[model samples]
Target chain A: MVQRGLLIVLSGPSGVGKGTVRKAIFKEDGVDFRYSISATTRKPRPGEVNGQDYFFVTREEFEDKIQNGDMLEYAEYVNNYYGTPRSFIEETLASGHDVFLEIDVQGALQVKTKMPEGVYIFLTPPDLKNLRSRLVGRGTDSAEVIEKRVAAAKDELKMMINYNYAVENDVVSKAVDRIKAIITAERLRVTRVLGELDN
Target chain B: MVQRGLLIVLSGPSGVGKGTVRKAIFKEDGVDFRYSISATTRKPRPGEVNGQDYFFVTREEFEDKIQNGDMLEYAEYVNNYYGTPRSFIEETLASGHDVFLEIDVQGALQVKTKMPEGVYIFLTPPDLKNLRSRLVGRGTDSAEVIEKRVAAAKDELKMMINYNYAVENDVVSKAVDRIKAIITAERLRVTRVLGELDN
Candidate 1:
C-alpha cells in the first residue's frame, strides 16, 4: 500500500528563531520531503535564486492564480504578491513525501480552511525579553523595524489558535527535536494511509 | 501553568503481545503514569491483590457502581462482571499523570465516547498466522481454545475504525517504541491546560 504523506504547516512570530530551528531540522535529512517554494512577485534579493529559493512570478501571474484558486494561500504585501501554488504541493503529496511549508499566520489560516487536518506547529520564543534581545541582536533592522516586528508578533499570536501543536524555540536543537517529533507523531495519525496497516 | 495529562486508551486482540509491550514501556521508569485498574466481580487468581491488580468486588457492588455511572466500561463475561471504574481514572488524570487503560475493543468505544480527543492505540499481531502461533505457543490452551481466540481476532479487527492510531505487534521492541513515541508526542499537545501559555 502507498502510504500517504503528512502536510505540516509551521508558523511562528518574528525573532522566534523558526528559521534557525527549521534549518537544523532540514540540515541532516535523508528522507524525501519537499520544502515548499513560495511564489513572489517581488524581485529576488542578492544570493537568492529563482525556482530553488522561490518561484518568482509577475504580478499578473500571481493574481491569475489567486483568482483561479490555484494558490492554496496568498496575500498581497507591500504592493507585491506572494502565494503557495496548489499544483506543486499536490505533486509532492502524491509522491509520498511529507511537505513542510513555513508561512505566516495569515497563510496558515487560509491553508487550514482548504486542508482542515493539516498538522500545525506554532513556534514560540523562550520569553518576551529573549525575543526582544534576539531582534536587537540581529543589528540589521532599525529600532523602528524591531518595533514593527514586535507589533506583528502580537497579531500572529492570535492566529495560532488553530495550531495543533506548539514548541518554544529556546534552543535550536531542542526545538528542532520537538518539531521532528511532531512530524513523526503526525505520520501515525489514524486518518493517514500508513496508519491503516493495523486495521 | 499546570499541564493536564492525556487520556490514552489501548485495545488489541488478546495474545497479540500488548501486555508484553506495555510492560516493557513502563520498565524504563521515571515516567510516572497510572495504568487504570478495573473493578471486577470475578474471583481473583493466585497472587492477585484487591485494588492492585483489580478492584475485586462482589456482584452487588459492581452492579451498584454501574448504575451510578461509576464504571467507564462494563461487560458481562463468563457469567461474571468486569469493568473500569471512573473515579480512579478521573483522580489520576486530575493529578497530571497520564492515565493508560488497556481494555477490550468494546470497552474502548465506550471510553472514546466519554473522551473523544483521547489517544487510541490499536495493536495488531504481525499477521494472523503469527497470532495463532503465539496463542498456541503458550501450550496452556487447547486447540478449541486457540480456534476461539482466532475467531475473536477477526471480530476485533472490524471495530478498528474507532481507533486513532494503530501499531502492529511485529516485534515487542518495535511495538513498545511506537507506543512510547505516541506518549512523548502527546505531551506536546498545545491546547490542554497549559494552553494559557500560548499567550
Candidate 2:
C-alpha cells in the first residue's frame, strides 16, 4: 500500500505574506502537492472555475456538511459559509497526494485539533521590528490602527509556539526554498519512510 | 549569544555508501558544516595532516583522554585506539558551527547516548536485493560470506528505528540533496528557531 501523503499547513498573522509565499510555492516547478480548494457558499466570480477555484456550493449543502462533521473547519463571513471539505483531503491523501493548506492562525489551530499529524508551519516576518515597520509602511491605516495591529501581530507571533516549524518570510524565494526543503525532509523522516523497509 | 550549532550524525549498515554521500555533501558549494576529525593513536600515512586528516596522538594521550571522559566514543582496532574527541565537537558547536559525524552504527549509538539532541540519520540501500547485488558484485567474497553479510545488513537496517531520518542512498547526489534538505529543515524547527523569536 502507498503511504499517506503529508498534510502541510502554512499560516501566520495577517499581512505576514502567507498567501504570497503559498502562491510562489505552487508556481515553482517540481513541487508535488495539491492546493486545498475551500468550499464556499458565496456566488462564483465571473471567471472562477467550479472546482479549480473554490468548490462552490449552496448554503444548505455547506451547512449540512458542517452539521454532519464533513467540514474540517468552517467559518461564516458576510452571510456566506466557507470551509474545507473533510472528504476531499482524506481521499487525496489516501491516494498518496500531499495536501497544502494556507490559512490564518485561528483556522490553522482548528485544523491542528483535527489533524495533529499535519506539518504546521508558521510564516514569520524577519523580526517583530520588521513586522511593525511593514505595518506602518502600509500608510493606509492610521497611526493608532497600526499600533493596535502591531500589538495583535505580537499575539499572533506567540501562537508560533504551536507550530512544528517557524519559517522566516524574509525573502519570497528563500522562504519557498525553505518550505520545499521542509517537505523533502519530512518525506525522509523515519516515521514516514519506515514503511518501505517493512516491504 | 550565538545559538549552538546542530550535531548531525550520519550512519547506517556497512557498505551503504555513507562515506560517499558525505563526501559529495562536503564537495557541494554552500553546504556548511564541519566534518568531525577523529583522534587516533595510529601513525598517519605520508601526507596526512595532523589535524586535517586525523588528530594523531600517542596511545598514552588517547588513554588519558578516555580516562578523563574526553573521548566521545572510541574503539581499539589492531592495537590502535581510535575515537572522537568530545572537546572539539563541543567547541565547534559552542562557536555556532555545526559538527557532522560520519561513523558506524555502533559508534553512532554511543554518540546518541551522549547527545540525544543530535540529528541521527540512517543511510539505507535502495532495497535488500540491491544491497545483496552490490555485495556480490564485489566478486571477492564467498557465497557463504555474502549470505552472512546480508544477514548482518538486515540487523543493521533494524537500527533505523532509532534514527530521525532514513535516506535511501540510491544515487549519491540525490542522497546528498536529501541530507542537505534535512539540515535546512532542522534549522527551521520551532524548538530551534524559537530562540530567535525570544529576542
Candidate 3:
C-alpha cells in the first residue's frame, strides 16, 4: 500500500528562521521531501536558479496560470506575482513525495483556505528580542523596515492560533527536529494509515 | 513559562506489543514520563508493586472511587475490576510530566470520552497472521482464547478509524520511535506553545 505524500505548509513572520530550518531539513539525507518550487514573476537573485529555487515566469504567464485556475494560491507584491502551481504539488504528492510550501503568513492562510488538509506549522522566534536581532543581523532591510517587521511579528504571533503546530526557532537544528517529528507523526495519522492499509 | 505535559493514551488489541514499546520508551533516559498506575481489584502477581504496576484495592474500594468520580475509566473483566484514577493523571500532567496510559481499546475509548484532549494512539500488527502468532507465542493463552483474540483484533482494526494515530508494531524499536516523535510533535502544538509563551 502506497501512502500519498503530505502537503506541509510552513509559515511565520519575516526573519523567524523559516529558511534556515528548511535548509537544515533538506540537508539531511534520505528524506523523501520535495520543496514546492513557487512560480514567481520576480527576477531571480544572483545565486538563485530558475526552476530550482523558483519557477521564474513572465508576468503574463503567471497571470494566465491564475486565470486558468492552475495556481493553488497567488498574490501580487511590488508588482510581481508569486504563487504555488497546483499541478506540481498534485503530481509530486501523487508520486509519494512530501511537498513543503514555505510562504508568508498571508499566503499560507490562502493555501489553508484551499488545502485545509495540509499540515500548517507556524515557526516562531524564541522571543520578540531575538526576532528583532535576527532581522537586524540579516542586513537586508533598513532600520525602519525592521521596526515595521517587528510590529508585524507581534501581530503574526496572534495568528498562530490558526496553525496546527508552532515550532520555536531557538536553535535551527531543534526547530528542524520538531518539524521532522511533526511530519513523522502526520504520516502515522490513522486516517492516512487506514487508507493505506485498506488497499 | 512552563508548558504543561501532554496526556498520551495508548491502546491496541491484546498481544499487539504495546507493553514492549512502552517499556522501551521508559528505558530511554531524559524522558520525563510517568506511567498512570491503574487501580485493580485483581491480586498482584509476583514482582508487581503497589502504585507502580497496579494500585491493588478491594472491590468495594474500587467501586467507591468510581462513585466519587475518581476513576478516569474502569472495567470489569472476569469479576476483576481494573481502572485508572483521575487524580494521578491530572496531577502528573499538571506537574509537567507526560503521563502514559497503557490500556485496552475499551478503556481507552472510555477515557477519551472523559479526557478528549489526550493523544490517542492505536498500535497494530503488520497483519492478522502476525497478530495470531504473537498471541500464540506468549504461551499464556489456549488455542481457543487465541482464536477469540484474533477475531477481536479484526474488529479493533476497524476502530483505528476513531483513533488519532496508528503506529504499526512491525518492529518494537520502530514503534517506540514513532510514538516518541508523536509526543515531541504534540508538545509543539500551537495551542500549548502559545499558552506557555503567553505566560
Candidate 4:
C-alpha cells in the first residue's frame, strides 16, 4: 500500500480535547498530515497571516469561490464567511498525503457531502456528568455560558448517528491512542488505499 | 483491571483465511482464547464423544434450553442440531477469560443479538480476484458450485456494514497484525471497560 495520508475529519463537542489529540497525532505519532486551512472573510488577527492562519479573502472572493467550486465546504459564522478550499486538499492528496480537517459538526457534514469517501470520526464525551464537569473545569466560560454549551452538546450527540465511527474521549491520551489505531486499521479497509484484494 | 475472557465472534467470507488468522492469533501472539465447543442434538458419530467435538444432547434437552432461555443460539438442519450453550460462555467470561466463536455470519449475528456488547469483526476477501481465485483454486468445489459460492459471497459483503470493524484479508500476516491491533485497540474503547480506567 502507498504511504498516503488519510483524510481524517475529527469533530466533537467542546471540551472533548480534540485539539489535544490532534496535536498528539502530529507530534507523537508522526501522522505527517497537512492541516486544511480555511478561507474566511473575517479579518486576520495580529500575527496571523492571510494564507497561513486562514486565506483572508474579501467577501467578493469568498462569494466567487462559492460559485466557482473552489471550496470543499464553507459556512457563515456570526456573519463571518469561512470555507475549506478544494485546491489545497486536492494538492495534498495528489502528493499522497493525508489532510486533517479540524472543524465542527456542521463543517464535517458539509465535507462529507462533498467527499463521500472522507473518513468522519466523532469524538464523544464519556458521559454527561463528565462532559458538564469538563465544560466547567476549563474555566473559560461563565456558569450560564457553560449551561448553554452543555445544552448544545445534546444537539451534537444527535449528529453522532451520521458519523462512520465514534471514539470516546474518557482519557485524552487513550483516545489519542485509539484514534491512531483506528487510522491504522482503516488504512487496511478494502475500499480505500488497498482497493479490492487480488488474493 | 480484572483479566476477563473476551467472548469474541469472528465471521467472514469463505477462502478469507479465517482459520489461519485464528490460529496465528493464538500461536504467534500467544493470546489466550478458547475455541467454543458447540452443542448438537444429533447422536455422536462413530468415534466422537459427547462433550469433546460437541456437547451432544437429546432433542428434548435442546428444546428445553431454547424454551427456558438457556441456549445462546441454535440452528437445526438435516435432522441434526447445532447450538452454542450459554453456560460455557458465561463461565468463560466470568472466569476472566475470553472465548473465540469461529462461526458463520448468521451465527455471529445470533450471538450479537443475545449479547450486544460482544466484540464483532468481519474479515473481507483480500480482493475480488483473490476471493474468486481462492474458491476456484482450492478445487474442492466444481465450477457450478464455485459460481454459487461467489454469488453468495457478493451477498455477504452487504453485511460488512453491520460489523463493528472490518478487517481485510490481503496479506495473512498483515491481517493478523491489524486484528491483534484491533483487539488491543478495543481494550481502550472506555465504554467497553469503564471499570478498568484509572480514577
The candidate that achieves the highest DockQ relative to the unseen native structure = 3
TM-score for candidate 1, please give it. 0.80
Question: Cα deviation in Å at residue B96, candidate 3?
Answer: 1.0
Candidate 2: which docking quality band? acceptable
- Give the poorly placed runs of model 4, Cα more than 4 Å off: A1-5, A42-53, A68-80, A90-96, A109-117, A124-164, A168-172, A188-199, B1-8, B12-16, B26-35, B42-54, B63-80, B85-99, B104-173, B183-199
TM-score of each: 0.80, 0.82, 0.82, 0.62
Evaluating just chain A, the predictions reach TM-scores of 0.75, 0.82, 0.78, 0.78
Q: What DockQ does each listed candidate score? A: 0.25, 0.39, 0.42, 0.22
User: Which ranges in model 3 have alpha carbons more than 4 Å from their true place?
Assistant: A41-61, A128-154, B42-53, B56-60, B128-154
lDDT tens per residue, model 1, A1-199: 3466778888877667767776777885664567988989999999899988889999898988888887989887899888898778878777787888888777888888887767888887666323456778788889988888777655655655678877877788888777777776677665662343422
Q: How many Å off is the CA of A151 in candidate 4?
A: 6.9
Per-residue error (Å), model 3, residue A29:
2.1
Quick one: best lDDT, which candidate?
Answer: 2
Candidate 3 lDDT, tens digit per residue, A1-199? 3468999988998888888888888897767689898999999889999879889999989988988988989888899998899888988888888998888898898888877888999988776435677777789999999888788767877789889999888899888889999999999998777666532
Question: How does model 3 score by TM-score?
Answer: 0.82
What is the descending lDDT order? Answer: 2, 3, 1, 4
Report the poorest 10 consecutive residues by lDDT, candidate 4 chain B.
B190-199
Compute the interface RMSD for each candidate structure.
5.2, 3.4, 4.4, 6.7
- For candidate 2, write residues A1-199 as lDDT tens digits: 5678999999998889998999999999987889888999999999999988999999999988988888888899999988998889998899999999999888899889888888999998776535556666677888888778677766866898899998989999999999999999999998877664432
Model 1 bad stretches (over 4 Å): A29-31, A43-49, A127-157, A194-199, B43-47, B127-157, B193-199
